[model samples]
Target: MAPTESQHFGVNMSSLEFARSVFGEEEDIGRSLTRGSIPGDMESVTLDSSTPWRLKDLELPPEPIMPLLIEAYFSRFHWYILLFHEPSFWNKTYKVYCQPTWRRRDLSDVVTVLIVAALGLQSVLQDSTWHGHNTFRIHHINHRQLLLDLVSEVRFHLIDLLANPRIEAVQVCTLLSCFYMFHSSPGLAWSTSGMAVRAAYALALHTKAPASQDRIAAQIRYRCWNHITVGDSFVTMIYGRPASVDAAFADLHELEHTDDLTIPPVLLDLTGFSECGDITSKVTFHQMKFRLYYIIRQALNRFRLLRPSQPNTNDDLVAISQEIKDVEASLAQWCQELPSLYNFEDWSLADRWAQLEYSLQNRPADIQEHAEVILLQAAMIQLLYDGAVILTHRPLLKYQVKPMRFSGSVIDSMQKSLDAVIGAALRISSFPVHKFEKHFVVSIVFHYLFMAGVILCIIPTSQPLTNTAQEAKAGVVRIIHASRAMAQHNRISRQTDKLLTELLKIAVQRETLAALDNTSVTGYHGDEAEPPLLDSEMSTTKDVPLEGPKELLQANTTTIYQPDLHREFSMDLPELLQSYHHTLDTGAARNELSDQSLLPSALLPLDPHSVFVSEQLDDIFGSLQSFYS
Candidate 1:
């Protein structure tokens, strides 16, 4: 028989059968072909040609407003650009915004200006309440309305801007991504960042510079490319998605060069009078950040490749673990090699907080500048380095459960890394709410805090109680408080606040039960040379009740730790640990289970062989639901 069109080098077959054979099954074929494909509705298309927001038809903000917006952008947001761009070029380009005919600027330039102005004004307003600046408040409200209108126009014209890609369009897209991030729209920020990455690649921004290009233009292009690279990696990690650009494909030679460029300092009072080394140090801070992000991206990639869903061999797990260790070592070395100017330890938490408060209350120009410098440097270095530590150690949270003997060093490292995370969170929370509003990177602070809380929860069960265990308990309470404060600015902080509170309760209950168990063992074995029950022996004991809901016990069981009797409740150590895991998996609170409010009074029978697939702590911690809120 002749082969049909759907058949491949085989006998004749029915169309449905052929389709199923070629594309797994009917459903798989449908999904593979239709996944994420745009629908036919014209209104839903972002790139519709008939959209009305043409540059000529757009309404520009008033002339007087432009200078204020420009000033705000330069004062607050320009450092992000100056991190990479030659300062002289930035100043030159910024001059165009001051001109009367700025309306005639390129469409991409207009979009860039509007986006920067929007972010800048929003940042100013977020902090204006702290400074009690009535003038800024009045201007902010009017400019906010203007910003809303401009943002809508930008969205309408974005497709047209990207239709013919240019360097300016790349800049616009990059700044737009930042705008979305600052506005607490990370998904949009991530999507816009992808657009910027693709546009930069299209413009060959990552390619080596051509000899014919002007020196300043080449420098700007290199800086822009580096910015996009770092930004893309950052957004990808924040979203827990794969990176758009690979490190191997990026031309990072310019970033590696140590030669000092005499560019105008973004913070004139801080770096204006410094030597070339100072300028290099400023550039190096960003370069180091980029390198650290690249390391994080690699760690994230390895994690994805070795996730539980995929079939994995012991060899695969070992390789991934080794790779993570390598990244951790590299990160530690990076921290040690940081320049003296970027010393993260120079500013104590108390000192920084005091400086910030004095600057805000007194409004001394020098004090304010000093505060800004401290925050800018501290936020940049501490957040990235501490975040890197968290990312590197995060894989261990899963691997710690494996059958290998628990290593004390692993626990120690976890403690130190968590401390770094908590320290960073404390430093950030000390700043006024408005200071955080300007920096989109502050969004990750919630993740850091949540991860710290998760580690604290695990530490008690994973290792024997010691001084570190005591510290872990104290750390959880501290994080709960910090998260509560941070929740004001970022909504993700609230969800973390709830989660940590719950974890803290579990830790307390577990600790109380463990302490009672120790005391009982001591008194019962008094005058005897017998050692206390091992964890294995404790697991099988029937006398002690678990420190959970009374419903977890049968009707025949008697409660020993009733508060009315003033006795201690006790449980088998291993069973208590198991109950902890069960509660985490099922979200079963002891009070809720006992009161029969959240769960049914009749408990479901447990199947020893049945598996309850709980979500990974890493996934729960990494989710941006709170950030989106």
Candidate 2:
């Protein structure tokens, strides 16, 4: 009745393949991160302006209301795009509005303002914390229609501006991409960004313009190009696509100083006065993320996806070993080098706003202006930093694919990846479920968590699952729970959460099947079906303290999982996972999970023969046998 080694790996392949397929299908890893279009199921956005409106016909809010929208964009949304000079933009806006005349050539600035207003209003509307937007949330102003009208107007002039290839067009394109990113339209964002980058190329923003251009004008060009690069490199990196920026030209015009702008323009990147009335020397969110992502993109390119080296070669293992050490060392160095304003290393694993609370309390007076902006940006930077660390060593997930008995060097490298990737994923899943509801959740945070969740599903969790495997599975559960909580609001989040939950259920059930080969399926009836623990081999798996659902390790055999000696999950997720496991074991995969809204109709049914599809056992089991030998 003992399960054969083939059967053991059969279970492994089925779950791993499902994990691969979930992200593989719109699920579209076959090409890149395939984002789904706005599903019909998305809460139907009510648009009041059904009829088409022209660019000049699209009216801005009244003159008095202009400042609030601009403030909303600068304070709530500017950090994400970093496209405008606050003072200069406002000055131009007043001039355009006061003159009451439009030049065919001068509509670019108007369009840029239009996009910013849309994004700013959207951010304010989406985030419950921003009470200022509530007053304008009158029944008459359909924010969605207003947003649509503005975007439609911008589009009318966008082609002409791009045809001419102006800096204003590039700015408009950059900000527009951000608007698309939030609206569940990354495909549009991606295509629009390509246009933005290509237009920048046309303007030759990659390299310095000749002395014929004014000094201030040249600086603004560098600043605009910098924004485009942020979007291009970031989107491409996360999407598993190629870089759109011309690196060859970027080096020719490697400019260090981007013209700084503050929310108040006087607080230039938060280095000047504040609500506290003190000249605080703070690094702006834009400056920090701009620098952070540049470094992260470089690390990702050099180490993982971009420049792939052979995984089977001895020389490659040695090289990877070196890279592993460098990655770990660099993470520490990067954290140390961060300015105190954005230093979030301590809060990386903590709950939302924890660092912000401590930080604000320690500052002069009770609080400072724009503190929330700093808080949101720091959290994002943390996620990006951690996500990059995981991808840097993601290839090592292959080590788990077959549970290799690797060389000492290979073991060291594989363990480092496990520690880094799972550790990062664990930290990401550690954020409270409420994080999904916030405006900060925009900018591909959901995708990053989904990426991590898929990796968690791949990590080895054999009998007497190692602490690392327990933590990995625990991390997966937390993500499913969080995403599921937000599923109703976000269609992508809902679908991903359900799929991952089903995948985890299947994974757990497969392990159970592997352990219960002697038990008959018909005998799996009601409460009596919970199989006894295989205690004969318990000592090894029991060496570590239980950090998650103890039921998952019911079979205490020798583990394939290599537990990280470092961290453990301190969150309450494990206990909930324990209850969730009980539901699974109690013939409740159908009823209990659905009752909890954890699984929907899409939950793959558990047929007796459907447990493990051995067919996917192609070369997926991987061949490091030569290395193992």
Give lDDT tens digits, candidate 1, residues 1-629: 11122322235455444565677754564343432113321222333333333354456654556556656665555554543243542465556544445332245555666666676666565454434245444555464566677677777768867765657677778877877774657678888888988777656676666788776667667778877877877776556567887655653535543233222343323321232235433466666666676677667766766654234334443554566677878887888777654555554434644553553665556445544654565556766776676566555434322222223454444345445544543443333333455554444556565655655654433222444444465566666666676676556678778876766556544433343333343345446675666664453233343233333333222211111111111222234345555666754433322332111112223233221111222122321122112
How do the residues 571-604 of candidate 2 rate in per-residue lDDT, one tens digit apiece?
A: 1223424544564566443232222211011112
Clashing pairs in 2: 23-27, 24-27, 25-28
After superposition, the stretches of candidate 1 with alpha carbons farther than 4 Å from their true spots are: 1-59, 80-105, 129-143, 251-281, 302-318, 349-371, 400-441, 444-447, 460-466, 486-489, 492-496, 510-629
TM-score of each: 0.63, 0.64
User: What TM-score does prediction 1 earn?
Assistant: 0.63
Q: How far is each candidate from the true structure, as Cα RMSD in Å?
A: 14.3, 17.9
Count the clashes in each prediction: 1, 3
The C-alpha lDDT values of all candidates are 0.52, 0.54
For model 2, the stretches where C-alpha displacement exceeds 4 angstroms are: 1-66, 127-139, 209-219, 251-285, 303-332, 347-368, 399-405, 432-443, 460-464, 514-629
Clashes of 2: 3
